[model samples]
Target: MAVYTELKPEAFARVSEAYGLGPVQEVVTIPEGSINTNHRIRTPEGRLFLRHTTVRSAEDLRFEAALLTHLTESHFPSPTLLLTKQGRPFLELEGGRVSLFKWLAGEELRRPQLTPDHLERLGLELGKMHRITQSFGGSRDNPYSAGQVRSWLAGLRRHKDDEVATVAEELEEHLERAEGQRGQGLEPRGVIHADLFMDNVKWLADRVGAFFDFEMACKDSYGLDVAITLNAWCFDNGAYLPELCRTFIRGYQDARPLAAVERENLFGHALFGAVRYSASRIRDFHLSPLPPEQLTRKDFRTYLARARALDALGPAGFLALLGL
Candidate 1:
């Protein structure tokens, strides 16, 4: 769905030789997600994922490769970054960066099929991943920072279009409230998967096969990742499933217990997560130049509704859902 460039056999052959991956037998394009081209490469040596992206800088791609390597070193379930003969994780080709990675075997779980058991596992895996990533020496600043949100809102205001104005108004209200409460409690900082939405996770049987797509990996408050996961995974039919959220927290606590600060700030962080997704979705769907078909636009309604609902629930109600 995100293939923006045509791939040729000759290019694959060059990559194979450069990486010593053996002769490339065939290449199949895998249509999933928006942004970046993904292809499944078959070789006599082994199966691998060949991903190409022009939108990100070479530095960003290299940072992602390093993050993936770090995660693998921590005994986490993530794809190993395949190195070139020159000992680099990516190849510069045709105005984009292409990287080969060991293909992970699993199916992506959708919301309808998700259960508390699944959330428990997701929580446990995320907890372990967070704990492991604490020692990662590399760091990337969050691309979706509060400042970025404010700038996006400013862009919307300049347009003067009715829809853009309405979205900007609503988003500003949420952002104002969420930003105002940032210091109610102290949140511990660490490496986090800033975009750990459901589609990014893969499952094999009952275990997490791998957490792919480290494109948005960055350093932030650890609670932000927890909040983002709960926002994405523990919701159904335009509402947050309180019991499911509780179960997820239970699983996370079993691995790494939440600090008092985390529990105190959970609701605010969740609201921040909701606002983040909603604002981005609006920018992508309404304001961005990319066509609807070329890029996937998640419905902004879900996150907006969740943000409003969480506002009504208040801190006590939100904490109570997690059995605090």
Candidate 2:
């Protein structure tokens, strides 16, 4: 329902012709995301997932295209971007840029339905992705680093709402502590899916179908990706699920073993992940100007609770919780 810019009939016709997809038969809006507009469109040829984004620059899109191409070459289970008749990865339209992907098959599982088996499979896939991308020559810096999140918190602190400002002030403290403790430049670096939440993955029966949503992929510490994914998958009912965390990390290490440095630095990375998402949910969902139906408002407080839990655990307690 986050269709900020709706496509017209003429626009669909143009896309169909440009991609040689034949006449468009059905167009269904995808109601999940917050930033970009997505649709499941069917033409005479087949069904395709169409994505339109005004926020991403051409350079960003090309980086994603290259990353996807590399993943495809590696035989990774990911969505394949279909080329236009001109062999371009994407098309420029009036309202925004559009990219069509051959619809990937699978279902996105909700939190309650996810099992330790699913986390294990997901972790293995993530590890494989990181391992595969180590040879990828393309590079982009992490956009949601500590410094960037601190800047976001600074802006949020000035908001008129007292609750938002208070939370932002608290988050700044957490960010400071996490950055101070983390050995910043010592971990193994690679291209990471910086936002690998559960919603970004798909499930086919008991196995992983695909890992989608590469918009936030960037070059960063490999440990950071593990921490971010751990935060996304292992937390439930206001607490971290220890068994799930253990299974996930074990699966990840099964593919590419974590270095001593990576293991030692996971605590700081996890804390930073909590702070980053909490602040982002505040900025993107809690304070969004979009109407209720257009965007789903995920409570920032859930991530705030995570930040608090991590702070209470400290580094040693966190490691113990993960059985690291």
How would you encode candidate 1's per-residue C-alpha lDDT over 114-216 as one tens digit per residue?
Answer: 8889889999998998898888888889999988988888887667688767877787888878877565656778889878888788999877888988888
Model 2: runs farther than 4 Å from truth?
none
Tens-digit lDDT track of model 2 for 1-324? 676787898998999999999999999999877688898999987889999998888888899999999999999998899889999988999767999998989999998898889888888999999999999999998888888999999999999999999999999998887886678557889899899898888889999999999989999999999999999999988899988999999889889998888888898898899999999999888998999888877989988988899999998999898878
Q: How accurate locally, in lDDT, is each candidate? A: 0.83, 0.90
Residues forming the 10-long window of minimal summed lDDT in candidate 2: 177-186
Give the candidate number with the greatest TM-score: 2
* Alpha carbon deviation, residue 238, candidate 1 (Å): 1.2
Counted clashes in each candidate structure: 0, 1
Report the Cα lDDT for residue 298, model 2: 90
* Model 2, CA-based lDDT: 0.90
